[model samples]
Target: MPRIFTAIEIPADVAQTLTFLRGGLPGARWIDPENYHITLRFIGDVDVHVAHDVASMLDSVNRAPFDLRLDGVASFGGRKPRSVFANVAPSQALTDLQAEHERMMQRVGLEPEGRKYTPHVTLARLRDSSSRQVADYLSERGSFRSAPFRVERFVLYSSRASTGGGPYIVEEAYPLAAIPAKRAI
Candidate 1:
C-alpha cells in the first residue's frame, strides 16, 4: 500500500522565503524547505493497483497553468494550535483544478475527502506551543507574501504512512497547458 497525494511544487526562491520564518516559536517542528508544497488532494493509503489507476486518471486532467502566491500566515486549531501554515492565496483556477481531481478520484471509487479544501503549504507542526505564542507569531509575520509563481505542473506524491508532514516522493507529474506568448509587431 502507498500513501498518495497530489500537489503543486514550490519554486526554490519562494521556499527560501518560507524558510526564514522557521524559528522563534518553541515546540514547533519546522518542515524542511525541500518538502514544501501546496497539496491538491490527500488520497490516503491505497493498493498498488489503485495507485496506478489514480496516476492514469490524473494524467487525463486538463487544465491550463495558473499563477499562485503565498500571502499570509495562519495556524490550525483555534484554541490550542496544532500547526502553522503559509496560506496559498485564493485563485479560481487552482480551485477548479483541485475540484477536477476530486471528481476524478470519485470516479475511481475512492472515498470523498472529508475536510473542506483550504489550500495551504504547512510551515511547521506545533506540539506544546501556547495560544500567546501562536498569536504573537502570527502577529509578527502576518503580512508574509511571495512573488507570484507560475504553476506549470502538478504532481502525484507518495509517502510512508506516518504522523503527517513528509518525506514525500514524486511518483508522477502532470503538466498543464502553457499560454502562448503574444507576438510583438
Candidate 2:
C-alpha cells in the first residue's frame, strides 16, 4: 500500500523559482523540486482496491480550471519550524474545488484527515532549528511571491514510504476544462 493524495502540479517556470528558493536557510531540509505541489487532499497508505475506488470517485468530480497566484511565504511548526511553504493568494474557486474533493473522498468511505484545508506548496522541512533563525528566514522572504499559474488538472499520487516526505507516483489524473473560447467560433 502506498500513501496517496490528490494535487495540482506547479508549472516549470513557477517551479524554477521555488527550486531557487531551496537551500537558503540553515537547518532546513529543502524539498526536491519535483515534490513541490499544492495538495488538495491526502489519502494515506491504502490497499489497491481503495486506490481504484478513489480514482473512480475523482473521475465524477466537476470543476473548471482555475488560475492560482502564489503569493507570500510562510512557515509552520513553532520553535522547531517543521515546514516552510509558499502560500496562495486566497481564491474561492480553489476552496470549492478542494471541498468537492474532500466530500467525494468521504463518500468513498476514506477516513478524512481532520484539518482545515490550507492551500500551500511546502518548500522545506526543518529539523533541529531554532525559532530565531526561522523567524529571520520568514522575514527575509515575507514579501516573496510568484506569478499566477493555471491549475488545469489534479492527480492521484502514491507516495513512497519515507521519513523525508515523498516520491509520489501518479496513479490517476483528471484534467480540467480549457479556458473558455474567447468569442466562440
Candidate 3:
C-alpha cells in the first residue's frame, strides 16, 4: 500500500525560494522544492477501496482560496534534530479548511490526526542532531517569517518510495473558490 496524505502544494515561485534556502545543514536531507506541500492530514497505506473512499470523501471539502504566509525556519528533535520545516501561518480560512478536511475524512473512515494542526511546509529532514544543537538552531532563527501568498488548491499525495526524494504523486487536486479581486485585508 502507498503511504498516502492530503496536502496543499506550494507554488513554483515559493518552491524555488525554498530550494535556494537549502544547504548549510549537515546530516540533513533537504526536500526538493518541487515536493514542498502543506499536509492537511496523513492517512497511512490502506486497501485500494479505502484510498478511493478517502478521495471521494475529500471531494466534499469546500475551501476558498486564501493567502498563506511562510515565514521563519525551525528544526525538530531538540538535541537530536530529526527534521526541519518552515512554519506556515494559519489564517482562519486555512484552519477551517483543514478542520473540514479532517472531519470529512473521518466521516469517510480515516482517523483524526489528534494533535492540533499547526500549518507548516517541511523544508528538510535531519539525519541526527543533539538536543543542544536543535535548541541552538531554533534560537538563531526563531523569528524567521515570510511574505504570504494565495492558496488556490490542495492535493492528495501518494508516497511511493523511501528514497527521501522519490515520487510523491499528486493523486488529486482540489481547487478553492477564487478570491474576489477587489477584496483587500
Instruction: Find the candidate with the highest TM-score and give its number.
Output: 1
Worst 10-residue lDDT window, candidate 3: 129-138
Please list the C-alpha lDDT of all candidates, in the order they appear: 0.93, 0.84, 0.77
Better of 1 and 3 by lDDT: 1
* C-alpha TM-scores of all predictions: 0.94, 0.92, 0.86
Runs with alpha carbons beyond 4 Å of true place in candidate 3: 135-143, 161-166, 178-185
* C-alpha lDDT of residue 72 in model 1: 95
Q: Write the per-residue lDDT of candidate 2 for residues 1-185, one digit (tens) a residue.
A: 86889998888899898876776688888888787789999888888888889888888776788899988888888766888899989999889889988988888798776998899999888887788887888888877789888888999888788876467778888998744555956
lDDT of 1 by residue, 62-148 (tens): 778899999999999988999999999989999999999999899999989999999999999999999999999999998999999
Q: Over the full model, what C-alpha lDDT does candidate 3 score relative to the true structure?
A: 0.77
lDDT of 1: 0.93
All candidates: CA RMSD in angstroms? 4.3, 3.8, 4.8
The global Cα lDDT (0 to 1) of model 2 is: 0.84
Quickly count the clashes in candidate 3.
12
lDDT-sorted candidate list, best first: 1, 2, 3
Structure candidate 1, residue pairs in collision = none
The residue pairs that clash in candidate 2, if any, are none
